[model samples]
Target: MARGPYEAAIPAKIADVDPQIDSRTQSLVEAATVEMVRFDAELGRDSAPFAALLLRSESASSSEIENLTAGARKVLLAQLGDRSSVNASLIASNVSAMQAAIGLSEDLSVENIGTMHHALLVSTDQGIAGEYRDRQVWIRGNSPHSAEFVPPHHGRVMDAMKDLVAFMRRDDIPALTQAALAHAQFETIHPFADGNGRTGRAIVSALLRAKNVTERVTIPVSSGLLTNTRLYFEALGAYREGNVAPIVELFAESAILAVDHGRLLAADIESALRDYRERLGATQESVRKILELLPREPAITAEMAADSTGVSTATAYRAVQRLEEVGILSPAGKIRGVRVWVAADIIAALDDFAARAGRRSRH
Candidate 1:
């Protein structure tokens, strides 16, 4: 098969297209969106930190969809500013994009999408982090002629993204359905050269947040998509072929799975928190504050703990020592020259969640 010199795919404008979905799909999407809203509400006002854990879980699962795998330990290390493991660091960077998505959810503009893309890859590819591709790129093969999918030429990218952002501004569409369509359109745009998949998934997250489908936490739809990756890719292909329902149905299914899986992981993290509370029975105010911060920063130094908890470094170290004594924090060795400690139960809970959310073929 000849490779290269083929015309790029010019995706249709979706800004005003009111695509219809079947009754079954509409029902599925409605149910999933409700469950997602319920789950986020149920997590409640106090469980906000669990939001970080769930976001990291989604980031890890999303990274796996791109074949970037890393153990929980190394990822925790990377989160602590250690860059020894490149994949772990990359996966760690994904959390930033997810965060940027939710933070910028109120205004889903092309500039903010680029901001999310920048947050995703700035650490790894500063050159292309926030900028749209200036050249044509293809998927899967050495050249465009042999590629599985070819996105639009660089000349069309800005306009394509503008249309996508315009489509996102519409409130008539259902939440999950809109998110699915936006994601498919983003992938078809392939706006960036390296981090499109991650940013595309982040766009799904941003829509979910903007639509208020999930208010407190990220629902791990990426992990749900991870459960059957071939099907997910096939759904994207179907969307590009003018069949939008498949992708909508996929997001519906993915949302249901995300909520189910997220509930289980939340239970695990909450259980660990209970145990930590039990171990520390009666503790100082600073110690109490540090315990609350553990799930978000399982691996940390006294400095980070102090900064996050608004306690003195000495007080934070004392609290860390107490937690270390009670087995809540164990030595994580060192990042650079500073000693770090980890909350073993929290990391174990995270690892367990990651293991359960790992790849599985759908029947």
Candidate 2:
């Protein structure tokens, strides 16, 4: 049934790539880049708080690309330190890794890539958390002979990764194109034993940050890929065949769709914020402070809110009580023993975004 294990994989040198993006694909990349800039500017315009909602969106959608599914409530609970659902915890770890990528964006080196991988898998699979594989790795089958892809040998992993990092640091390439090629090349390299897909996607996020395509908000490009993974995979396959345009075009299309969907999610968040404003007509500073924090910290405790808002525990609890009375916040069970309050509307909006992102068809 199966044949030979195949010849040793030839590692491609990709440090200096000149992608041949066609006219249509080039236009699409231009349009997508402009839309991404516009979309980021629309939502709070460089505020760190807004990044939370979309970062969660991006991470969850990215995880869903690998079939790691979790409802938004579970993910929010996990973000608030719940960690009950295995999938939710994993998705949350993906979120953490994304944050790590963004944090390490300024550096963008081989070591930081390992650090991002470590952040992603340390909690779930500590043994191989940040370490590159020392053995051959193949994809999609029981043995290398039947595998869909056999990456370069472990000995070549670091060297190829170094080349990729070098490519990532270049300024001649367009941000979207660079990110696209970098992602496909990293996937081609397949440096790590596990979590390659997620880690590779996270590096895209980092590249966007490093290139300054997005400063405070994530584009959720993976959500766009989530819509039609067949095409996405086909594009990756084409990349391996030395066709760079397909992946670049896919990233462009995904960016535009992600921007459109992100706008809808932003509308939902804006509406929730408006509802909070109406319900919080004559609140005190502490109540106002906690309310401001709700978009970023959907599931918050009184103590946590107090510490964040620089108020006493009693003041924070009173604020939570006021928000709860106004129907903006509600109890979401306890974390350890303290009752955690959640912004139900915010979580609902994010869940709706995730649902739409995961929905089939792209129009």
Candidate 3:
């Protein structure tokens, strides 16, 4: 019996991703670098909140990505506040498995494996969450012999994952190159019965985070991949043939593109924030005074802002009006005098992030 593509599926060596700098590639990287530097300087004060919200917006758009995001958020929020009611134990478990599977740690323990698989299975139970197949799975319509076929030992998928985790933890290589190679390897291994694609993408994010490649930032790589799924799968197929160069190049190129686009997004947000800040001016001092008062009574009248700011009721109304205009606050309802305003800027920032990310996914 011949194994054909199935036998030749896994990669044996790490992909060689040379840092060979071509003028054009260097130019693109350089531009993204400058823009990122500028963005960081301008938005450093607000990066934490911005990153937290953006992570949620991007991850929730997809089921698999959402699980990892949920896990990370759970950890992040618990450190900041009491998260007893906002539990995400299963998502956290899955994230741990991803971290282990991708070599973020020295050993992939039984507990880690159990956690990820449980998340995957339970995630499916919620709806049509991606599920694993017990038998060998095939790419539909790709195999020449048949429309679809499964390998015999599909249940041992986790065994392959153990090997993957070992490979990810191998420190003898560069992180960028390791990331690309590991992604290909994980996909080839097809460790899970289902959710492999999203899970694999999450591993890439976790590896970047672990390796300091992203430096507390998540690149929306899946949006780039989803833009051209054909090319994505083709690169995977190329890896199956023992040619890693193409896929490595593809990943690097995508990384460059994503960073460049993200830089633009950062600039847009920074500009918006700056505009809102400038518009507040002297009136902003009044608004701040009003905000200080709101905690005691979140639902207050515009007159309250005036009384707190020592301004006339008309002046207070105008200040609240400005905050509403810039998305800094929103009225509680259609009620006239006693209007409640909430911090709306955070939500707007998140919305902008999602829209830009969605556009990237469509591209």
Worst 10 residues of 2 by lDDT: 1-10
TM-score against native, each model: 0.97, 0.96, 0.58
Task: Give lDDT tens digits, candidate 2, residues 102-140.
Answer: 999999999999999999999899999999889988988
Candidate 3 weakest ten by summed lDDT: 73-82
Choose 2 or 3, whichever is better by lDDT: 2
Q: Judged by lDDT against the true structure, how good is candidate 1?
A: 0.90
Model 2: lDDT equals 0.89
Clashing pairs in 3: 132-193, 132-194, 136-150, 136-151
Off by over 4 Å in 2: 1-4
Best by TM-score: 1
Ranking by TM-score: 1, 2, 3
Runs of candidate 1 exceeding 4 Å displacement: 1-4
Clashing residue pairs in candidate 2, if any?
none
The local distance difference test score of each candidate is: 0.90, 0.89, 0.52
Clashing pairs in 1: none
